[model samples]
Target: MAEQINLDKDDLITFFIHHLDKVYSAKSHLLKRLPEILYQVHFSDLEEAIFETIKVVELQRKRMAAIYELMGALKNEGSISGLTGLIDDSFEEIKTHQDNPELRDMSILFYMTNIEATEIASFQVLQLLAVKIRKERIKELIKENYNEAKADKALMLLITTKYLSTV
Candidate 1:
C-alpha cells in the first residue's frame, strides 16, 4: 500500500512549484532530443514544422523559468517519471522504425503530441492552483502556456492527418 499525504494551501503552492520544475526539466530534455529526432526525419516539410515548434518550445521554457523565478523557486529537484518513461519509449519506437521513413516521422509526431497533451494537462492544474492562491501573474502565465500547448497539439494533429493521408 502507498502512503497518502495531505497538503494545505502553502504546501499546494510548493507542490505546484515542484511540478513546474519537472515540466522545465522535461522541456529541457526535449530541447536536447529534438535535433536528434530531426536528424532522423526525412521529410523536409515535417522537418521544418518540427524546427518551428522547437522554437516555440524554447520560448515556452523561458516563460516557465520566469514563472519559477516569480515564485521564488530556484531548484528543480523532482523528476516527472511518466515523461521520462514516455521519452524512453518514444526513442525505442523510433529505433524500431528507423528503416521506415514514414513510420519514423509519424512516430516522432505522435511522441510530440503526447508531450504537448501532458504539458496542457499540467498547465491546467497549475492554472487552477494559481487562481486558488491568488497568484494572478502565475495564473496568466499558465493560461498562456496552456494555450500554446493546445495549439501545438492541434498543429501536430493536422500534420499527422495530412501526412498519413498522403502516405
Candidate 2:
C-alpha cells in the first residue's frame, strides 16, 4: 500500500545513463590496467589475444562515446564498477605467481575470462535498458558491444582450454 512512484522514459533514460557510466568506468580501468597484465603474460598466443582485447576495448570505448554523444549525456567521470575488484584480484594473483611464468599465465587467462564475463553481464543489462528505452540506434550499439564482449569471452574460454590441455 505504499505510494507508487510513476516513472517515465526520462527516468528510464537516467537509469540507462547510469549503467552506461558503469561500463565506461570499467573500460577506462581496463585500458589502464590491461597493458600491465599483458606485460606479465609469457605465452605468445595469450599475448596476441590480450593485445586484441585491448584494441577491442578501445573500439568499445569509442562506441560508448558515440552513444553518450547521441544521448546528450556526459560520461560520468567518478563512476566505479565491480570490475575494479576483479582486476585488483588479478593483480594479486600475478603477484602471487611472480616467479612462475606458467602459473602466471594461467592466472592471467583466468582473470581475463572473468573480466570478459563481467563485461558481458553489464552489456546484457545495458541491452535490456536500451530496449526498454526504445531507441533503435542505441539498441544497435548496445547489441554490437554486447556481441563483441560475448565473442571475447568465448575466445578467452577457448584459449583457456588450449592452455590447460598442455598441462
Per-residue alpha-carbon lDDT of model 1 for 1-167, expressed as tens digits? 99996658898888888888777787777777788887678777678778987898898888888898888878574564766557667777777888899889888888888988998998899899898878999899889889999998898898888888887
Q: What value does the lDDT take at residue 54 in candidate 1?
A: 87
What TM-score quantifies how close candidate 1 is to the native fold? 0.89
Over 55-166, each residue of candidate 2 has an lDDT whose tens digit, in order, gives 9999999999999999999998544436666777777777798899999998888888888888889989888888888888988998899999999889888988998898
Cα error, residue 33 of model 1, in Å, equals 0.7
Whole-model lDDT, model 2: 0.85
lDDT of 2 at 7: 66
> What residue pairs are clashing in model 2?
none
Deviation from native of the Cα of residue 94 in model 1, angstroms? 1.2
Worst 10 residues of 1 by lDDT: 77-86
The TM-score, computed over Cα atoms with residue i paired to residue i, of candidate 2 is: 0.91
Q: Which candidate wins on TM-score?
A: 2
